[model samples]
Target: MNAPTHSHPRVLVTWESKHGSTAEISYAIAGVLREHGVRVTLSRADEADIDDADDGFVIGSAVYAGHWMKHAKHFVQEYSKKLLAKPVWLFSSGPVGNPPKPDEPAVDVAEMIECTAAVEHHIFGGNLTPSR
Candidate 1:
């Protein structure tokens, strides 16, 4: 892990996960960012404090019916201005099966990305546990 070049490089990692899968992704992301010497705060979308983080953001959510969770969407709406002024990255966790179908389209965060002018976006495979 490389030490962050910037002083106090804080990153806020927020997400919305109905089944804990997306939260796992958020934690993993936070861990990686911390390993790189970034100060990280991991929280649910509704719980994150926009003012608490000034450097960057990594926001993610689980996709359902081809859309992001409502709380995640609301978080972006509420913090759009602040997010736009900083470096932001977006991620989506879906495509549950081991071998994702080729026809599965990527999670759509284009509107949010446009609003924040996000530096990057990623879509990751998710895990689904069937209820017994």
Candidate 2:
């Protein structure tokens, strides 16, 4: 179970979904942030308007080949300055399975970059199911 979210202003959640599971998680995250009084918006990583959104960000992507989707990576680069200056939370949706893996670990995409937002990154179990 996930813990409660931190409240903030102008929270933006950007996601990349090949089959929409990543999107679902991103929306849930935005919902929780809104519940906590954060003004949030969920959009495709490529579609986010990063202009003066200097408050906060909640960026996420679906992992593919041990990496974040290309669009999400680009989004981070595009908003690198604003992100670093603001509070940010990064997450990924991947490594779907039932547990018991000694070698495999979760990967957080935003952590790989030089984030501008004093960001905390997390990765959640993601679905490979086509129907999800």
Candidate 3:
């Protein structure tokens, strides 16, 4: 008997951005995944389709006042059962300034990880523009 061979892994990269910075990061991450031959679907957390047949997930959100945007949080909460079956990675974009103010993970990250059974979490620097 022959073993099964899988096609390129499909990954969903979703995010919620208050001022667009986090969305940009999500796009960049998807681009890299595609470059490595992964099938990537990039969508906003609110608009993303959780039912897609993805092998893994990369979820991100912009942190404001130490909390993730509601849509991202809701996404995790709403689809946690599905998410728990696969590998999930979480990211937060916030803490601006030289050396990054606060220099800590988003306040809700721990809970999000627990809910999704995420394998890892990353914190990225955010860009703050006064105009937005």
lDDT per residue as tens, model 1, 46-82: 8877864459899998887778898888898888899
Q: List candidate 2 segments past 4 Å from native.
A: 1-8, 98-113, 130-132
In lDDT terms, how accurate is model 1? 0.83
* Whole-model lDDT, model 3: 0.91
Compose the digit string of candidate 2's lDDT tens values, residues 34-132.
888878777898887785743678787787767788888888887787677777777777866677221343354434446545456676776777654
User: Could you say which candidate leads in TM-score?
Assistant: 3
Q: Give the TM-score of candidate 3.
A: 0.91
Candidate 2 TM-score, C-alpha based: 0.79
- Highest-scoring model, lDDT: 3
Decoy 1 TM-score against native: 0.86
lDDT of each: 0.83, 0.73, 0.91
